[model samples]
Target: MTPYAIATQYAVTLLPETDINSHFYEITVDYRGHGLWAITRHRECMNHDGDWDWEPIPSERTDEWIAAHRFDLDTALRLAKEAAPHVTVNGITAVEALARSARREAQS
Candidate 1:
């Protein structure tokens, strides 16, 4: 499996104004049917006075959002590395190990 990541930008809207802050991103790679999924959702602390408190954004519509943003897996991984390189890692080894184990099981 290829490396994957998710990035999010926060836009705060007051009753009469708007503010944008640092973009938050995360990367995760699948391995042996398990992997780490780290997210830094809404890391911006630029909440202005009288602005609504930060609220969790729904990800159920992520497919639509990804389409709207015109982001592909490569772009996503690149963005993730840019935002947080330490979070991304290789998973090919784990996948290979899993596959070998599966093949052995099948033969058994």
Candidate 2:
């Protein structure tokens, strides 16, 4: 099977308005399938129009982002699903993709 990474977007709206912190973000989970996985989180930006959008911020891969070999693919996918309501992968939402996979599994 081809190695794939699941990218899911998330937002923090429940935080108090007075809280000065990131509100929009994306977390990309790269599962190596050996109980190893890496999580890279990117913060979304708000443009002048006040619309939330993604802007790739280039930076070095420091200790902040690294692989953790402690979970299986199922756990990784579950995490992807937990990022629901805002998770989009390859034009298809994570919930949709996961539901489709479930249907296929059920058929098999």
Candidate 3:
């Protein structure tokens, strides 16, 4: 499926150190089939040792992550459409791809 991208305002740090740390991050919640979603948070931000500190964390279709992060199917679709409604593949938007994937799982 075409992964939907969500750009969060900015990373919240306890210390609020530098301007670079305040930059926005494009967090992608990828649908890994079987009603599973994994969130890829802060891909650009690296640790002092040069490792991806924020990796893709797994979540269920009906998890609290969906509520807190507002990543449910409908919400994701709305956000994606608002961001780039014109982007399509075979006339299907990112959210439509996600919906199709969900429907496929349900029908099976």
Compared with the true structure, all predictions reach lDDT values of: 0.30, 0.41, 0.38
The residue-by-residue lDDT of candidate 2 on 8-73, one tens digit each, is 332322222333321322444454344554333344323223233443433543332222222344
TM-score of model number 1:
0.23
Q: Distance from true position, residue 43, model 1, in Å? A: 12
Q: Could you tell me the TM-score of candidate 3?
A: 0.23
Better of 2 and 3 by lDDT: 2
Candidate 1 whole-model C-alpha lDDT, 0 to 1? 0.30
Higher-ranked by TM-score: 1 or 2: 2
Clashing pairs in 3: none
lDDT of 2: 0.41
TM-score list, all predictions: 0.23, 0.29, 0.23
Query: Which one is best on TM-score?
Result: 2
Angstrom error of the Cα, residue 75, model 3: value is 2.1
Q: Order of all candidates by lDDT, from best down to worst? A: 2, 3, 1
**Best lDDT among the predictions, by candidate number:** 2
